[model samples]
Target: MKGRFVTFEGIDGAGKSTHIGWYIERLRARGIDVVQTREPGGSALAEALRELLLAQRMPIETELLLMFAARRDHLERLIRPALAAGQWVICDRFTDSTYAYQGAGRGAPGERIAWLEAWVHGDLQPDRTYLFDLAPQLAAQRRAAVRTPDRFEREDTAFFERVRHGYQDRARADPSRFVVLDGEQAVSTLRVLLEEDIVTLCNT
Candidate 1:
């Protein structure tokens, strides 16, 4: 049986991590066997790469490559296996990040990134993607309150604005598979929306 793969994506400080647990709990309460993981940091090697990528000083190209490298390891080691075993895999981020961060944010060749994704994982795409939509300035404020900003998070507002648009573009292009959620709302409100989506996904 093919298991469900759901990915959560958005610009940094979009409150995705803050809301992840709510979804996890809702799924487990319904007796679903869920495997929760985050990209660029799922497995040991991937986690190491995540640290390097998030550090304050790394070339943009290096960051992009590291993200992909972690993704390759994450898919082969954890994601695919969990899905094959009929587990619901909920990932924090996935290929979409590469497109937004590298392709749109850092101005990498879009075709090259597309080629890389296909080359690395032929048919491994998320069944559903939930994109938390919010302005970069608001997101930055939220980010500032929680923890120190990472390399990506430290980018100027203009850069983050581009990243937000990148996400929006991806979602718009694939509306059938992507759901945009208003991320500026209260966490309680977001939880309700997520629960609704979860019910629809599981029941279908």
Candidate 2:
């Protein structure tokens, strides 16, 4: 059987970071062979792009292109291979982030992102995408004390508002593949829901 591809997404501080480890631990305990990776930093080349993407300012088009470039490398070098070998690939973020951050947050055209997705990724899509939904104001407040904000993190509240909207739109359009989870809920509660969902997914 081809392994499952699961990607977790959300705005900067929407509690995804807090729960991912716990989720992965449970997945591993269930005897799933898991490969935990992250976007823009999965492979060596992608990590380089991740650094540039987070530190440099460029045109929205440029930023979006670089993101796809890294993704191509990540998919080819790591993600595809792992899944082909029957190991579940759990990614921290993926193309959805590009749509939210570059397409919506930066005002890049939807057509442009669509074009790139087709050309770069073919028909590949996540088996499941969990969105940790939270308000931008609350998310920003959670991360206020973090040291040395990255480019995306440094963006003002309005930018994140657009990003949050972009993610919500994605969830609405693909309800079957996208799971929208309220980020304000207690981690324990969310974990239970996540585990139940994953159990169902794996059984299927």
Candidate 3:
């Protein structure tokens, strides 16, 4: 059987990262083989690109290209192989992030992103995507309480608002593939809900 591709998405500090490890543990407890990874990462080359992408300030078009370049390397080196081995691949973020961050936040043309998406990994989408939806202000507050902000994380509230709307738009366009979660919910409550969703996905 082919393994499922699952992704977690949200604006920075939306709390999606908090559940990733727990979700992986849950799958392991059920005897499922799994590979946990994140975008602009998951492979050595991609990781190198990740550091540059996170810390360096560059043109929007350059940033978008680098993002997809990292993704292409990640898919070829890790994601595709893991799935072929029947191991579930749980990624922290995916192309939807590009649509949100680069396309919406940076005002890059949607068509450019779409073209890159097709070129990088055509028709290869996550079987399930969990989007933690939160208001920009709340997310910003959460971010401030955490570690120092990175390049993308340092964006103002307006940028995050655009990104948040971008995520919502993607979810609306593909409701069947996205599970929109409320980021403000209690961690325990969110875990219970996520557990149920994981169970259903595993069974399917």
Best by lDDT: 3
Instruction: Provide TM-scores for the models.
Output: 0.96, 0.97, 0.98
Worst 10 contiguous positions by lDDT, candidate 2 = 140-149
- lDDT tens readout by residue for model 2, 10-126: 999998778778888988998988999998789999999999999998988788889999999999999999999998999999999988999889999998999999998867899
Task: Output the lDDT of residue 183, model 1.
Answer: 94
Candidate 3: regions farther than 4 A off: none
How well does candidate 1 match the true structure in TM-score terms?
0.96
Each model's lDDT comes to 0.88, 0.91, 0.95
Report the Cα lDDT for residue 184, model 1.
Answer: 84
With a 3 Å backbone cut-off (N, CA, C), the pairs that clash in candidate 1 are: none
What's model 2's overall lDDT?
0.91
Residue-by-residue lDDT tens digits, candidate 1, 98-129: 89988899998888888888888878889899
Better of 1 and 3 by lDDT: 3
RMSD of each: 1.2, 0.9, 0.7
Full-model lDDT, candidate 1 = 0.88
Position 96, candidate 1: lDDT = 90
Return the TM-score for candidate 2, rounded to 2 decimals: 0.97
lDDT of 3 by residue, 85-180 (tens): 999999999999999999999999999999999988996989999999999999999889988999999999999999999999999999999999
